[model samples]
Target: MLAFYPRFIRTFDDLPGQLSLLIHAWNGCNMRCYGCHNADELIAKPPKDHLSGAQVVERLSGYDAMFDAVLFSGGEF
Candidate 1:
């Protein structure tokens, strides 16, 4: 199984028609839900560890030319 990261790029094997990248927005969430699938990792993240929105945008821009679409993934974008 794939270990999840707060933010990273992944290419899908099942998506249709175009080459896409999946980017997990961050390592945390604030809304606590019952039986949360990813709450453990989300809540435990240090606020200082992830990139800012501007940083994410700058990084992905380089790959936008190569990918058909960029999917921003995570609890909240």
Candidate 2:
């Protein structure tokens, strides 16, 4: 129910292709698979103030034309 844009992409000078926005949906995951890089953080409780889906869309409205796709990430449970 929450998402965040964690990357700061200022330009496409050194990029290879069209850009995609990565939305970190930190809603907590319990999988805890071995070798998982985000195991510790994802297992912890998420904050109550995280932005809703609507809020995320509204906040990124101005930059609509910047990216070609929106990639929802994080959370495995």
* Candidate 2 C-alpha lDDT tens digits along 1-77: 44543332343333447576656665555455678654554445445556767877777889878787666656552
**Per-model TM-score versus the true fold:** 0.55, 0.55
Instruction: Give the least accurate 10-residue stretch of model 2, judged by summed lDDT.
Output: 5-14
Q: Give the lDDT of residue 8 in candidate 2.
A: 29
Model 1 per-residue lDDT at 62: 62
Q: Per-residue lDDT tens digits of candidate 1, residues 1-77?
A: 11234466556653688787876545454456678654555556544466666676677776667887777555654
- The superposed Cα distance between candidate 1 and the true structure at residue 11, in angstroms, equals 1.6
Candidates in order have lDDT scores of 0.59, 0.58
Backbone clash count for every predicted candidate, in the order shown: 0, 0
Candidate 1 residue 52 Cα shift, in angstroms, is 0.6
